[model samples]
Target: KAVICETPLGCFGQTICYDLRFPHLYRKLSQAGAQILVVPAAFTKKTGEAHWHVLNRARAIENGAFVVAPCAVGKVEGGGESYGYSLIINPWGEILADAGSDSGLINANIDLEEVNSARMRIPSLRHDKSFQF
Candidate 1:
């Protein structure tokens, strides 16, 4: 799912958990003018342990957009375990906050200007070229 939110700052895009695995989706959202990406996930313990933080950071760094992932903590209805490392990552791949297995909020003072700064430093988005396999 994609959500385009027009906040006081700029356009923010929201994607569901599984959508985080798709980079192209985030790129499309960025091309359509998304500066921040929010991912709400109930990432499984198994996969999350191996890929959660890295994926979220990679997405933010590569797209030059802030990544805010709010993950579900503790056991679910079906006895499924969720990796609760909810994170707030900056455009530069910096971890602003991490909620590690706790039931609480992780706050970060995000500066929208950093998005532009990161993009300016490495303009990968503008450099993308489509090629056929």
Candidate 2:
């Protein structure tokens, strides 16, 4: 299930690690009026290197919503490493901030109005159609 929280800034939708793989979940959240999607992940270094950035940007682009992903870095308890590179992406899939491989902080100024602008320009969400087979 998808959950959303309404705030003064925007309507945020939450998802944890590994949920990044599923596009339908994001679509559900966006359909429910989510203007921002938050993903807090502890992705393995291997997978994150391969998929993290692209997946985050894809979600934002497809949904016309912002994606804020704060990822875990450094060594894990079990042995492998957690990939860092925390990201703050915009509705147009532009990377606003990226906290490279170390554990630190990164921030960006987000305009909720960009959500409306991006959606207006793309209008893909409004074009969604039911498929019958």
**Each candidate structure's count of clashing pairs:** 0, 0
Model 2: per-residue Cα lDDT over 1-116, one tens digit each: 78999999889999998899999899889989999999999989999999999999999999999999999999998799999999999999999999999999999999999999
On residues 6-97, what C-alpha lDDT tens digit does candidate 1 reach at each position?
89977899899999999999988877778999999999889999999999999999989999999998898969889999999999999999
Best-performing candidate as measured by lDDT: 2
For residue 43, give model 1's deviation from the true position in Å. Answer: 0.3
For candidate 1, the per-residue lDDT at 68 reads 91
lDDT of 1 at 41: 96
Best by TM-score: 2
Cα RMSD to native, each candidate? 1.0, 0.8
In model 1, what are the clashing residue pairs, if there are any? Answer: none
